[model samples]
Target: MVTTQRLPASLTPLDAALAAVLRDLAPVQPIELPPVDALRCIAAEMPALRAYPPHDVAVGDGWAMRANDLVGASSYAPLPLAGLPVWVEAGAAMPDGTDCVVDADAVDASGPLPQVLAEAVPGQGVRRAGSDIAAGRTVIAAGEPLLPRGLLLARAAGLDLVRVRRPRLRIVNISKGGLAVQLIADTARLAGAEVVRLKAGPDIVTIANSLDTGGCDLIITIGGTGVGHTDAAVNALARRGALIAHGIALQPGRTTAIGRIYTTPVIALPGAPDQAFAAWWAIALPVLDRLSGRRPRTTLALPLERKIASGVGIAEVVLLTRKQDHWAVLAIGDLSLDAIARAEALLIVPGGAEGFAAGTLVDAYMLRE
Candidate 1:
């Protein structure tokens, strides 16, 4: 069903070339989802339904009344208790004639009437109508993440649903083992992509055809990109469409491949957990970000305390540990999950450079995935 082909490891393309190819892709159509289900999704656009605190409200426990009523009130000669002060608690609607709130601590509320010990400012202790969020203001802008706080904002604005840009994604692990697929699926979900898993039998041709036929925005496959006889992903992809990139210079994931069947992108990652995770960020995450209209992860330049060794012509990946005010180099080549869990960031030694020396500056990618 499939045949093996191999190329020397040095023949792989540069990492920048692969990244350029993935950047040209565009986002897919958006989907409507309730606020609860839209967590971490990319927002299409959010026009608020109603203003937060649509009416003027009391923001403190005390009486709500006109500020002018306490113009001469003072502690030395406090305003005597009136028949009664309009009592209102926090979040209660202020009475029609009230323009300010006298804080409970600023007045004596124990008695039937209230006594003011301080002058009341016009806006003190009062949450005016639409004060936090104005009416018709855009709450969620285009390409912003629908985080928990954003959901709360939506609820405050009287919105029960939101529109998010979520592309359909399909994952297929060429190997019989399923761990690689699980890792890929987790990463995809983190990027807010809707994942659909496809179970392919041992037939490589069947696997290839099924992957190419799916309408998903992206297709991800694990294993079968190496040099062994069983490594057949390249051939399978070649049977359908072009393999844009066969390999990348980055360590651990040198054999990662990218292909396209018409408009949908297909990514083939290594079977090893470390390699798979690294490639998922270095390669797949960027593609997903572009398609969903989300900004790429921020990169921080930090100083390394120890020398990190790497090749000049090959792209090298190094992990960094957080030290006091700076970072320590932990270039075990490519980091495993457990090692990365302990590390603070992933540093990159580009194909243009050899490596970084101790106390030198290195550009590192933050742990965003």
Candidate 2:
């Protein structure tokens, strides 16, 4: 059996740890899924089809005509064009001769029919086919996380299908039962990934040997990631491959370890409930996103209810929630499973975060989807 040593105790920010994990790890092959559909995933860098508006389209509900038609016409002396102005509403095809839109409001129907007080300028109120988007242009660039709005735009651009990166996560753990296991499985399900848990002894050889039959893309060990003698997951991972990072410079889940075994990403978390949860949330999630060619970003924010003390050297992720307009913490301990179970979001007290005041602006991640 091989033995591997850990890095310094300096706690790195969550992003940095993930970046280190992603370093040298090969990106997944892009796959052609289907027509440009689906909202959750991102589009492949170079899409399979060209985007549009190949030409300009209409923008408002009005008649399209040349600007010179209504040059001198006014509310009183409205211009009565010799040719009939084709009636069109918002988003209708412009008339063959119409180059601009004379809005319905800008015209009067006092005499025989609709008469415009003044003529419209060329290109006024007209949406050029390709004005909003151009055909043959890169609608969604590579490495950009596809948002709902972006997906809609891509569909509108006339793309029938897209190539996207499939981000698959593989989980290995000992606890296949209990609330912790249920919660872990639930988290993976919510993230739309597959999870695999293993019940191996804490011995490094036992854990390493079990992982040898590798079928997973990424491996996460639930128990035995701490400093205890029996905490051998990290050593096992290193024995199988190489250590990437160990013991980030932070709290509760500081013993968290990340490495690569046989070219697959491996992460080690504390055995305690809350610490393990925090480790997965803060470290594993971002690494997964990066490996999937996505930049990790979160929006769940919670204000600080009360002051919390933190170490000066390491970053801290304090769990917080909204309690009657004031933020209240369930507890500060890493083992405080109750608080983690009930948290609305994670309060990211960065490295060097001292104790915050009662009203400090703390940012947190949402626990629920």
Candidate 3:
């Protein structure tokens, strides 16, 4: 039966809602993936299998010679070479019995007897063995995102694959999928989750069946989370699993719901783009981080260019853009499409606080790198 219900008498607190969503959830096990495939994934500690540059190599195009041989050698008192020094190209392994490299011009090769015109210091212009990487050393630490720079180091260490934790996310669009769903999917993917998109309607059975959590670490349902007659996401979740929070004390996304099917976490977002976006930052992001064992996201502390007035009862989402050195508020409480698109960062005002005054230093989470 389709059971219609009224709005929640009192909305659940934001922190309590988040705690219920994270209850009994643990980080998924790490998997082996190629460095290219592991981009943005939470990396597992990777120990170098072998030392890089196992042998001394030239760092530049020059002649390899013994630094001791060129001691006190200068243009005024050129040291004559018994034999022409070995020519080594950049990146080539230095020949045995050589400890330094000198530029071609430093060697007077035009003359029948080559003479050293400049002194060379030991280890100059040469990359020593294990200088880039040491054997058995930790090159990539655990709980950090595997970026391109980390991948470069992995490749240099001769690692074909890296270990990372990438959570599988299933997005269930409870209505005709549109831009709102697309935005959520893209955001989840960018957060290092493998996204799978599904579709359903407002019908209880259809929405309940689509809530299946098999093979996915998390599920996010878009649309039908409100208290209207057609809003059946909360009812469907209650029938299929445990509904943790049906209404949250958050602006723009008050109808958002949190639940769990079996062991997988599920977040039901409203259909509106602004509402879904606000919930994404305030709720979904924390769940993703916990599932992937990701480290704390970076936030910038900057002063607000102007005063922001907010209600004291509900947590409000604030969109901001960097202006000169301070953060300029683009929109408060309800964010518009234009504001969301133009926002460079986001700030959330606590439920207890009314708002911030001008020149108040506030921490904002970066939306873009």
Candidate 4:
């Protein structure tokens, strides 16, 4: 079996360090998925074939008319028209040959006949076709996460379906915990990603066979990833391929391992439930987002009530709750599953001191609601 080398703790910030490591390593092999079903495809961006508001659609309930027809029309004395002007309700299509819309609010509609009280400008109240989005323009770029509004926009642009990069994933469960595996599988399912799991066994052939036969785009081996003699998951991965990173300068999940198996990424996590959650949130989640062509965004930091101390040289991820607009430490122990369970955010205090003073500014990332 090949032994693995431990990653050095550089003086860089955790985010920067993680980024540098990721930059040096290539992303895992990609998978193709249907646009309609590619909800969480990594790094996928589709262009708008047709512009938003593809045609001139009305923005309000009003009258559609040729600008010239209303040039001299006013409430003082109404100008007669050839009846080209028609009443169009809000969101109604502009009539053919009509170049403008006069909002009903702008004119007195209480009259038996709708009358215009003011002259309409050339482009007054007109929503020109392709104004919101031009044809053949890229509405969403690669590396942008699909938001709810964005999805709606894509559909509005006439994209019935889209091609998305699959959310390649690796789920490693260590120790004797069955709950961890179940949770990981459930999480992957919710994110629309495929997963692979492994139990604690010393058989290299079984491990290798799992890698060779699986449909996973990434690998996750849980439990045995720490300093224990049975913690050979990292070693096993290195023997199979090159090591990416073996240690992180972060607390609670500092022993996390990142490496490669062929072109697939293998991430090993600590067995503790809280540590596992931290590793997944701080590392795995961002990697998945980057690979799937989505923009990387962290949880927002809420206000803090007290000073918390972190390791002098280790980046700390603190579990906390935003109560009354203040971020209160949910639990001081990194291994506290209760803390994680109660947390709506994971606050990052970069590796440095043994702890944080109350009120120190720290970064925070919000969890999915």
Candidate achieving the largest lDDT? 3
Of the candidates shown, which would achieve the greatest TM-score relative to the real structure?
Answer: 3
Model 2: residues with Cα > 4 Å off, grouped in runs: 1-23, 35-38, 42-44, 47-51, 60-62, 103-121, 134-137, 176-215, 223-250, 254-259, 270-273, 296-308, 311-316, 320-331, 335-369
List model 4 lDDT by residue over 1-369, tens digit each: 545334455533557546744564444444444446555444354544677675676777787777786677776787644333577876666788888888765455555665666788766777778887778876457665455655666666766666555655556455677665675666655554655555546444445444442566667666666665555666667667766677777677777777766656666777776676777777766666555555555557555788787657777777788778777888654547566667777776766566666665566776664
Q: Which ten residues in a row have the lowest lDDT in candidate 3?
A: 44-53
RMSD of 2: 6.1
TM-score against native, each model: 0.88, 0.65, 0.93, 0.71
- Residue-wise lDDT of candidate 1 within 1-369, one digit each (tens)? 334657554545556646655756998778888888888889886665577798999888887878888888887867766656788988999999888887666687676666787888788888988887887777577887778877888878877778889978888777767777887898688778988887765456866776754668888888878888767777677677777778788776888888888878888888787788777877787788888988656677777877777877777677777787577866556676777667678876776777777888766777753
- Candidate that beats the other on TM-score, 3 or 4, i.e. the better one: 3
Which has the higher TM-score value, candidate number 1 or candidate number 4?
1
* Model 4 regions more than 4 Å off: 1-23, 28-35, 45-50, 59-63, 67-93, 100-126, 134-137, 160-163, 172-175, 185-205, 213-216, 226-250, 293-295, 299-303, 323-326
* lDDT (Cα atoms) of all candidates against the true structure: 0.77, 0.67, 0.90, 0.64
What C-alpha lDDT, on a 0 to 100 scale, does residue 146 get in candidate 2? 57
Flag clash pairs in model 1. Answer: none
Clashes of each: 0, 24, 0, 38
| TM-score between candidate 3 and the true structure | 0.93
lDDT score of residue 96 within candidate 3: 98
TM-score of 2: 0.65
lDDT of 2 by residue, 1-369 (tens): 434434464656656787788778765676665443344554557644443555445687776677877788888787775555666777776666667887776777666766778757888888866666656667577665556666667677765666666555655564433555556666754553445666777678888877653556677777766666456787887778887777886577888888877677888776666677777777877666665676545554445667788777666677777787667876664547667767776765666567788777665666654
What is the model-wide C-alpha lDDT for candidate 3?
Answer: 0.90
